[model samples]
Target chain A: MSCIIERLAIVGVGLIGGSFARALRQAGAVRHVVGIGRSRANLEHALSQGIVDEISFNATEGVAGAQLVFISIPVCSISAMVGAIAPSLAPGCIVTDGGSVKAEIVRECEKLIPEGCHFVGGHPIAGTENSGASASFATLYQGKRCILTPTERTDREAYETVARLWRVAGANVCSMDPERHDRILAEISHLPHAVAYALVHAVGTADAEGENVLSYSAGGFRDFTRIASSDPVMWRDIALMNRRALLASIDGFSASLAELRRRIDSGDSPGLAEFFTIAKQFRDGIL
Target chain B: MSCIIERLAIVGVGLIGGSFARALRQAGAVRHVVGIGRSRANLEHALSQGIVDEISFNATEGVAGAQLVFISIPVCSISAMVGAIAPSLAPGCIVTDGGSVKAEIVRECEKLIPEGCHFVGGHPIAGTENSGASASFATLYQGKRCILTPTERTDREAYETVARLWRVAGANVCSMDPERHDRILAEISHLPHAVAYALVHAVGTADAEGENVLSYSAGGFRDFTRIASSDPVMWRDIALMNRRALLASIDGFSASLAELRRRIDSGDSPGLAEFFTIAKQFRDGIL
Candidate 1:
């Protein structure tokens, strides 16, 4: 495939940004990749690792003259990044983000977007607990889902361009309303993380005698708590940024758990069995 | 590596019983294996697959002259099996069970154990979502932990013999009080299963429009809900047999989750981050 953009500026080059850059480079979809971040050492490392063609410490200067700008940062910092780079972007520059929570970013960044430039809220549902440029690879987004939240005011040409970029990188692109995206993600992603964190805390704190109960954990506990080992700051920002939807998800899950608890307390073996049977059917249909 | 027992009888030829028989046969630990079950097809399948040397539909007749008896069935049915075989077992025969919950089994079976015979409670901390004889394998118990719960009245020689049986099958043998074993297992194993079931049901039931939300779940959701696909009947029995400890675990988990919900509702980003950091640290320390 031919290069889709003359210059691609990636702000906050970590796992998501670094992986996008690498994937774009491998697909020959971007001619030059410019990385922008606060840490000079990380930017230098990204340059040395060949994930980015160049590195810059200034977001405004880094985004100048770039036809495509990808903001890959925490959900809390995305709005600030948009505000910082809005003044320096070219008139026709297309700006997109890799934020987990979409509604806040779309609401805040859409208002600050400069005239003639396009801003589309995007989220790539592909990542691991590991972060940093060194943890990135070219095939990270292969066969994964990338959601684009484009409004009526979004430039159709810009949306197509961003969608094509993700497609070239081997991702299935789908579009939805920003609010709907956040609500769905709350149920699928954020709620699971909350449950994982709570589970680990419950078991860890239960060891009053420091018995190290985790040592006896088998495959089930290990797999269930794997997400609890994710990045704390990122999850914290996610939980806060999507607070309303996340709170609703917690309420829903709490109700289900309460029902299960009541059944167990009543010694209603048939009810418990029926609950598990339905859960098993649903779980088997997931994939 | 020679045959450790002259004859062994497996009262339930399912995953656990069949695997135990296969592992013992592979290790040359038992000269003859007798398979007994209600399903004649499963017994025939076990016999054809070489998992057992003989097949019998009668538990009492199958265990009449055996030196070792292993009851691998649901927790609720274990006491009945002991009663059925108690009248026909030979003297000095060592009998053990592979049940998830131990307290109830030990408390009930110890009374019906014939004089000169021994009953020890055993739980093998190894299994998959699959069951039946077709899923049995010789390496299922290799490198896994097999816990034995013995009380003050347990025969020293019989306990040593059961421990040796599992050790010969390449398992790490450990002993604990029956109540203590049930408590620890409730925290690590049973609670995780409960949480998984609730999570799946929460998401599965939330799709009021039948949007098939689970089709969009990522790796985290998949791994977190893996245990939800486990057998419903077995888990139902476990929930009822170990009700008190599981209820306590559910209460602890609910408290942790409620605290997290409060922090999310208050938009306490720092508190949420601290919670995740502690959870990550605990999860990382698990093994």
Candidate 2:
């Protein structure tokens, strides 16, 4: 496993990509890392921090001759970035991503990738509300789950190579169908973000004697809405790319909430108690 | 503030009551604390830990000759417990609480207390998801906000006395109308709890290729659902007492969620970004 990757190209060198580069560097698993991003200041900072061996504003030039390319950016832009840099990828180069939604992105990447190259959809189920290269650390992915979504046509050798990188970064890699990954993430991750953001919005706008409700928030309120402070553009793209599943999740949550409201409105004490009891049990069951 | 309270009676003796007694004792503000609750095991544990000077199961006997009484039980039982202890309270005894919902509890307790004894509705805006005497700590209320809700009929001297106790425990005390407190709490605290519980229930029950979504939850999911593990019976009582305001909050949250759904469903990227941007700003505004 000594320098298994000769050269690695990281597009959108933000939190996810910078962390991947740093983790791989720390493990001595990757050599000659090329960081490509829209932010010159960020790329320079990453270079100064020794997170990347080289930097480029042009994805095509950056990815040229790279054995592996990791696309970590907004979900909406991943496919276009892949398309823009496709011709520059080496014949045996494998491309993967750190995108949240997988189905559409994987489909689009598969369609755009060169015939001899490969595309794998990967999502590391790890992050804080903070984003950017400055917010990343070498241990960000330690013991975290990284789900790789591969369709039937995906090249097995390329998939294994990509999985090795995540494994080397201390992540436990698992596989799921592209669509299944999208659906699960929509429920497990996207819906919770939406719920948090909406709760904050509703509470912030609520008035009590003209006092904003959020001003008096305590620890519980702050913890519940912590995810609401995440990168808005990244989440917006995630919501759109995973629209149908997210919509369904929202409906499911709305129904659950409506049932709670009904029980409370009807003064059904037993029913309310039962709902909260089940919720508590289920919440406690999450690892 | 040397032993301002000669004897303090505490009902429920759970996290809130136990913490109150411990904090008061730490401040040397209460000479003796009588811990009253339905659970003999918990009462004995509280007494053993010196959280309460004595333990009692009889509410009437618990408050006899006590200068201050703090009821920190489930909201639904606050009035009945106050009634049972009302005749036993000495003249000028001040009865307060750590209930989340205030208007209804205050009204009910104000009616049940004896003439010489005063009822002051107070809510210490602090707690953990854990409950019972074991979860209590001496500094639980330090630097926390304690909102005292008093009506026009509330005794000024009794209210001041209760405020002094909270201040001695290192709490910043403020006064508000009972109904206003209920509305504000419903939006700030109750709604977030409801959202967390509903989100967890919805995700835990969701199927992804026959897999449970909660199994793959990350740190964000765990943080978002932490409040859902709060005491079920306690939340059930709060939900019932704060029914009207919580119902409105549910509707408000539903509307906010609907707007997000509309933006995502319509593929309005700018709108979705704006929505998330505003939410992030608002959430960041909270301490």
Candidate 3:
């Protein structure tokens, strides 16, 4: 479908936000794109790079005439942004977010949202290490999955509108329970970051040999370092917000680790072999 | 030096071994590169692809008159091959290996080594998921470190020869104690593999809703799965042979994981923030 929406407004002109605008426009999914952000420089940059047809620092004016509004701010600011634009949303406008955590965002917005506006939670699982408008490319969302978590109060029309937009941008849309989404991602995404960060410290910390360990950290440690190099503030907020689920994943990992330790201490070669072999089987199934 | 060595022998035609041959040939490090393997098809393929100047299925025949011998077979088979070649190695021949663990191979070879053949354990800190000769690339060693663990018994001339050859092939060479090498790599390399495998199986062994969890395994779970997709036999042998150091690394990781769990359970916001912030600092040091 060409020009599924007449206007698409993206609030936050960072990597994810700029990428969505660029991809939609290049794919002909939206006729006109509007960019909104707290940073005047970012908005100007987005407009100059053709990521948006219009630029507005004022949140209300940005969404005034838009059919689709995407709140692409960091997780910590999702609630405030939802509240800021809730009062001025165009009639029957659809609102979705690209935040990592959904339950909290959904819960905060559900109670204060304006009537007739659909608030469907969305997270497009497409990104790169680079950030900002210059780093964004038009094909960033091709073949990636976008998850839509709609609540009971969410309008069906709003959900479909967001799904259609994602589909036109070359994303496969899937539905999930918000709570389950948070928990599953805690194990897969958040825990890896936490573990990688800890491992980085463990290697770089004050070993008697100084940076000898860190100097030789290129083996497998380099990969861990990249994941650990993510934005500190973003990861800090994720760990604090998803504390419960992150804890559950850590517990599961600890139990598995403890079992390994017991076998090692007892010199159980057969047991260790069995454990590693089974683990190999499970990972093999994924690929 | 346009060409340093007149002849070089690589004992296995796997990714690392084949890549070493390719890089050496591409850089004119060695004039004649010989590949030795048990698989007839692999030996023929290596010859046809110009990965080696010659192919020999017999270990003794492979090392005869060769100035440099590289043992690139699996860890378990390292000792037997060393024994087979020790009796036939040319006088003043220098030998090195691409194995992950250093101490075991050093210990096994030190017992049966003949005079004038020196064993300097080497670990090239590079590779990909793909294996075998066809997957080999010439730039595999570019900008990577190659750690050499040489004991007091190692001949100075032999050590320098190995270092110079690795340097010629585009690797930064450094020296470390074999025992220390095992411990350091256990944390940076071995334990990560173990944890990746365990995380995969941990999700698999979860309760009745495990299928749903597996389906959503694309996020960061895919990263763990990618690492765990490593050769099962190779990993199993590593876990079994390097039992002492691998287990110790697991203990260290377990402690860190437990601390994360405790902070999450108690809702210790400061603790979580401090932990993540400290990790960020360490990760930044690497970059």
Candidate 4:
């Protein structure tokens, strides 16, 4: 395959960003790669690991002549990074992001693109609890789903280019509106994270003879709380950035939990069994 | 190792009961094993699989000359099983059960012990979603915790014999008050199951443009809902059997979730971050 892009720039060279750069380099899809991050140590590590050809501390200077600028940062910082890099982008430079939430970033960053530049919202539904440059690998996105949200004003060529980049990284790309993407993610991702955090907090705060009940937690509890061990700041930003949809999801979850609680309290054995049956069927049907 | 018991009678030859019989038989700790259950097919399967030397449909008749009677059934039926086998148990037989909840079972079953027999509540902290005689294995109790709850009236010799049986099955035996056992288990086991079920029910009921959201569920969601795929009748019986502790845990979890909701609604970024940090720390500390 021919080189898809002559120059590629990635801001926030952490797990997601470093993984993207490594995968593209291994695939020989890009000629030059530049990494930008706030931490000097992480940038140095990325350089030594051959994840990028060059490094920059400033987003504006990083994308000076790049044909693609991938803003792989926390959800909260994506908007600011886009604004910072807008003035220095080359003509027709396609800008994309790797963040969990889509609507807010797309809404806030679309108008900041330069006249000849393009912006597309992208999210790769793949990661581990570990972060930083050392934790990234080339196969991080293999067999994963990458959702791209494009508005009516989005340039079709730019959107296709971003989708191709994800495909090169071994991801299956799907397209949907920003609003719908955020709503679907809220139900599947954000709501489950919230439930896990709440569960841990509840068990931690319970008065159970000052004993550490976690030592006795079985395989099921371990599996259930695995997501609760995610990065704190990243999840906090996601919970706030998608506040409206997340709140709606929480309401729906609360209502369902209340119904289960009511059934248990009323000694309604049949109702409880039916509730569990429905949940089990849905759980078993999960792909 | 010397044989621990001359004869072992297993009531309800399903997952737990069959597993106990198989594990003991593998250890060469029992001379004869009699399996009893309502399902003729399960009993026949257990006999064919070498999980038991003989099969019977009547619990009372099965324990006639047995020196050890192991009752493995749902928590709800332990009381009646105890009453049925009390009259048939030999003078020096040791009776024990494998049930999730201890207080209720111990309370009702202790009184039914015959004049010279002993009853000890045993709970092995091991199982999978799959149940039945076919799922039984010799190593099911290896490296697992088996909690024995003994009352004041319990015979010391019988309790030690039960503990040794669990040890022979490759389990670490621990003793605690029945009430304390129920309380701790409610937090670690029952509460997590309830949360998983509620989460599944919540997402299953969401309105997402008629799309099956579970089809889009990623690895995290799959791990979170695994326990929700458990046996519905089993969980329902557990919920009703340990109602008080489960209810308290539900209330505590609601409070925690409510606090998280308030923070998200107010856009308290730092507070949300702290909540996730605490949860992550606790989750990481889990063994």
Which model scores highest in lDDT? 1
* Clashing residue pairs in candidate 1 (N, C-alpha, C atoms within 3 angstroms): none
Q: Which lDDT tens digits does candidate 3 get at residues A142-164? A: 88888888878888888998898
The residue-by-residue lDDT of candidate 2 on A117-138, one tens digit each, is 9998999999989888898889
- Candidate 2: deviation at residue A155, Å? 1.4
How does model 2 fare in lDDT?
0.90
**Candidate structures ordered by lDDT, highest first:** 1, 2, 4, 3
Superior by lDDT: candidate 1 or candidate 4: 1
User: What local lDDT score does residue A281 receive in model 2, on the 0 to 100 scale?
Assistant: 89
Taken in order, the candidates have interface RMSDs of: 0.9, 0.8, 2.5, 1.0
* Per-residue accuracy of model 1 over B154-230 as CA lDDT, tens digit each: 99999999999898877899999999899899999999999999999999987655555677788778988989999
RMSD of 3: 3.1
Ranking by TM-score: 2, 1, 4, 3
Tens digit per residue, CA lDDT, model 3, B105-138? 8888877678877888899988776678888888
Could you tally the backbone clashes for each prediction? 0, 0, 0, 0
Q: Which stretches of candidate 4 lie over 4 Å from their true place?
A: A207-209, B207-209
What is the DockQ score, from 0 to 1, of model 2? 0.86
**DockQ of the candidate models in sequence:** 0.86, 0.86, 0.47, 0.83
TM-score of each: 0.98, 0.98, 0.89, 0.97
Model 4, range A43-147, lDDT digits (tens) per residue?
A: 999999999999999888989999999988889989988988888999999999999999989999998888989999999988887889998999999999999
The CAPRI class of candidate 1 is high
**If both were scored by lDDT, which would come out higher, candidate 1 or candidate 3?**
1
- Give stretches of model 2 more than 4 Å off: A207-209, B207-209
